[model samples]
Target: MLTAQDDLIGHQTPAPFATSGAGDARFTERYWYTAHPIDGSELLFDAGLGYYPNKDVMDAFAGLTIGRRQYNFRASRRLGGRPLETSVGPFRIEIVEGMKRHRLTLVENPSGISFSLEFEASFPSAQEKQNYRERDGLVEEDLARVSQFGRWRGWIVVDGRRFNVEPAMWWGQRDRSWGLRSEMRTDETRPPVATHRNFFWTWSMFQFETSALSIFLKERSPGKPHYLSGTEFKRESDGSVSHREVVAVEHRIDWANDPLGQTIANGDLTFQFDRGAPRQVKMHGLPTRFYLKAGMYGGLQGWTHGDDRGDYYAAHDVWNLDDPATREVARTLSDHVIKLESAGDVGFGISEYGVATGYPLYEGPQKFPAL
Candidate 1:
């Protein structure tokens, strides 16, 4: 059951900006957006912005993957002004119509990538159930997140060339989440300890010509089972949306070694909705990939608030494409465009798979086991 406060706290329209919450340093607000061509052009672009209230820090990243090459841009700074007026160095985000529409703009940065894109929701934003959990002296409050499927309108320029973005050709997904995440460790003296040994998370959004489907899952420690799962399907028949809690899930991942010798996995996923039949989906890796290694653009191994040096500073590292090791790692972290076959209908979208710890991809005792 839900209450009035749930509606007030979960919706994005009324609260389009960040709020000072009781969680302090753990309180974080962030946005992730991705756009890809539907005509199989093999071009992918993604960007994300994160704000930490307790630390008064803001960070943003943008990446473009073309052919077998990937370009990344990143920036971080101390929060100086209003949170709603989004601006971080050369990157800026504008909320055009509260939750219904938003715009992301990036001027030419050191990475030589710039874009002006607008995301308008095709359906009302869907909020996940309040995720409240207490374990091992840690208490997680209303860790609320909302997601929406939408189309992109604007243009993206790479180097000096311009590519126009149209709704008919380009579609994307966006999500806003605020809460205490394990990745928010910035304090120097009091470092965050590992809460769990290993966790597997997969988030996917499949967009069809007239409908869309989104699925989310999280598995901890012994990766054979999942701890949480949810699904949302919007049908074209009457423009109605159906929400279901996934009852069970089964997946298989084909493992490969990256340049750094780290294991990466990509594979097929199946979901069983509580009210309906099962759905099958296959994920295919793209030639270009995002390297999130320790010091790399999106890697969590580095601290965000330290002096601007080493892994702490926002920087881009190009891979040695000729080297077999580097090429293997890129193949592991690369984005996967997925194909879905369900109920005699087909759909296409992006898929994200990650493993925080353990080597479930290999046969061995896990490196980090729960205490």
Candidate 2:
């Protein structure tokens, strides 16, 4: 099938855009965005879109948090007709100006949450370290991603209440990645040997007035990393961008006494630069959180990413954030609003944290303090 993307000069293989060179069903592309207030507020929003070319499916989700309640909307449809189309149901993402500006909108629906916001980048996009992994000789993940810091200007209406979004008061981050991610795919065959049970990961990006910092780490055990990178992007006076290398990164988290011990109460992230003394940033957790499952990252109910829902399918629901039982099940691989402080300056960003069985970062007695 020929589509608009086929006309572009960017083709890895001698096939149309409707076809993926990789035969694996897990070949996918995704776009994600998040917006929150610079000043502490009970409002936050995030949305994501995923396209599974091999599976012939495309899905997208949007979520909004107000106080202790979170409203969610999800949609899935066949991946055809318009190969370059980024809209699913009522959601659409428009690239007004390549990497500089984007417009995201959610029309009125039964979910009672909709918005028309534009994201304008403050700094140019930076390439992140590759996320590649394999287990038992099977390529589990091979992806490349780029991240940017930006501001949002628009309005959001939730439950009939309208909240105006101003670029000066709101800030956000956007990332685009494409590759073979096993989390979005299912494995029907069991491995002959049991794989390791431990997994720990944390990704955070913070922006101050003049510079932004991003730190990413994945580990199977303490002091062992599958991938790690710390980068600092600075804006120069001549409209040029410069990069600062981070020699090392260290983190310590105080877990909250929750059901699964996955919630973080606070933490300290120290970045050791190549030329200067280490910079320490303190993180204070907020009351609100965004569950990744809502966007089909892990799984939502019986639905998983890349699943063939139908030619056209859509669903949505609301979750009560105040319920302990609900939060217990939804807290895994979640996003929490964090207040960052360092060198007398304060910033806000999201702390995306997840832990599996054998991570021992805070296993010692002294690290497990009373919440």
Candidate 3:
């Protein structure tokens, strides 16, 4: 079952490229990309392609939001036929220049949504340290990730309307990650737990004029941080790039009166450096919202990732974010397009935050802003 990828010099296992070292059904490799306008006028979207060697499945999903309408497209197929194919139904992703550039496309489908976008890296990628976690003697997460900030150039069509995306106005961030990411599964064979507390995590990458910032935070409890990292990639005047490590970070969030009390209405994040004074950035949520469920992360209507959808399956659905009744039912742990302001300089990125319980910020009265 050797494919063309077997001819390459990179080989991790003694078997063919199709074989994975881990026999766990949770092992996965994924390509995830998100893009939005700098000002976030109306459009924000994210797409992903995932491979599960143990499960012998590959799937691709796209979620797009225009104004208050959210459109989702998903497709899946059994692996092994086209061992190296990057396309699933109408969704396709091409690595035009490895880490430098990429082309993502979705042909015309019944969903009435299509796009052909090119992403060019603005700076070298930042490789984060290995992320490993275990609970009750079970290895839950073990993975490595590389992230980059870039700009998107192309166009997107929703239904009958067309929108032009220019590199100067459209910013994006992408990450290539692989390993045993067990959260992709819907069923878990673990010990029963009586109490379920909240889980708080945030991962964001913002690009400024001359530098980009990447932040990752995971809390064990209300005030105890299990993992934290802050990195700044600075571009010098001579075109050289450098990275600096942050010493600490503080989250000052004003929570929204949502069902879960996890939404951030308005807030600021202060990042402390080793030597220079700390930097504080104001954060504002854009009008467009994109959730992970639409991409099959947390499952949409019971369609979770790695599920056996037979040889080929494609589906589409739409939701109106403006409708309060629909919003409560469709609301999940989601990502928001964020506008960043520091010292009057403007930047933008996506903020992914999930809060369940044990979060200290949600203890007091929350301000219910117009959602």
Candidate 4:
């Protein structure tokens, strides 16, 4: 569903790196994606995760898998000035480390799959959408089905006016084991990050001018794929709207493992997103409890397979600006608005946000593309 001259996974050689210095971090994991209370009539798909490390490294994960029936189609579309998105089907996700070799997978649930999990997707607003967390959607400890065939597509409607994306993608059936990923740098020879696969953070990312909106996910101690991480950005803009750089990032702790650290009121709050305006927005999130399920991906950090759990709504804000170094920018409402809703443990939100991003455009992840 995308048309790029180069592979979404940048063609680059792997480079050595370090994660949390050298420490013995042993992790054990087990997963079971069972579909509980088998509902063969509903077309269940459309979920994913996004990851952002610092401001420069970005990647997302999306997939479309069916649970019942024979086959299905899912697409991601943005309507209303790139503010709202309609994932017209299942998950629109891709994964990327440092390129190397990324994998893409499609699913059609038929056997038995039920796992408690959280989901995040922003629409109508870029700055405030921050991909809020949904307590439970497809996470639980129960029996589920895995369909025979499943299909996924990405139909992006950028600019908020009409179709502004040129898409050309290579898609196969739901039978393959590959996964999709989009990256700015691809280290083909690297080990972990360059494997082009993220068993953990699998989601999608988008940048408009200096404004960036990235969404990803990770399972927590009790739930698999439980927490949703979002990085909303805005920057000084030149003219013409879409060629600015992302100058800031908003850093706020939404959730934590400690029950005493779950609420925004009890959690740490600091604006490390920018250096301009001293701005803060209040959030009235849904209840912190729910009944959900989760899925395990081999070895993970946050959860195990078919995990059913609950937590507080952590944090929520309408419009807040910050700088590239996680510094606060200016108090500008020129970018976003927010709304929250709930149906018991489930949460619903609509954000109308955008930002002026101004990061230097690099031609090959190193040198800036000469104008």
Q: What TM-score does prediction 4 earn?
A: 0.24
**Model 3 over residues 1-371: C-alpha lDDT tens digits?**
67777888988877877777457788888999998987648788789999987788999988788887889899999886585888898999999999999999999999898999999999888887788999899898898888899999998988888889899999999999888885633212232312334556678888888888988887756446778777888899889998877667877777666563246677788888767777888888765678666777655566778888999999988877767755544544466888889888888888877554555555542222111
Task: Tell me how far the alpha carbon of residue 268 in candidate 3 is from the true structure, in angstroms, after superposition.
Answer: 1.7
**Tens-digit per-residue lDDT, 1-371, candidate 1:** 12233333454534323335653576777888888877777677788887775665677777776665666777777654444446777888888897789999998777678899999887667776666666687775547888888889999877666889998888788889888754433222344633444566666677766556676766764435544545555565766765665667777766454434333345676777778777766655444344433122223334443123322335654455456755443433334565555566666677766555463643331232211
TM-score, per-candidate, Cα-based: 0.76, 0.91, 0.91, 0.24
The candidate 3 region of ten consecutive residues with least summed lDDT is 185-194
What's the lDDT for candidate 2? 0.78
- The residue pairs that clash in candidate 3, if any, are 198-357
Angstrom error at residue 89, model 3: 1.1
Better of 1 and 4 by lDDT: 1
Error of 2 at 259 (Å): 4.1
Candidate 1: 10-residue stretch with minimal lDDT: 362-371
lDDT of 4: 0.21
- How badly does each model clash, as a count of residue pairs? 5, 0, 1, 126
Show pairs that collide, candidate 1.
Answer: 258-328, 258-329, 259-325, 259-326, 259-329
Candidate 1 regions exceeding 4 Å error are: 1-19, 132-135, 140-142, 184-199, 220-226, 256-266, 292-335, 355-371
Error of 1 at 272 (Å): 1.9
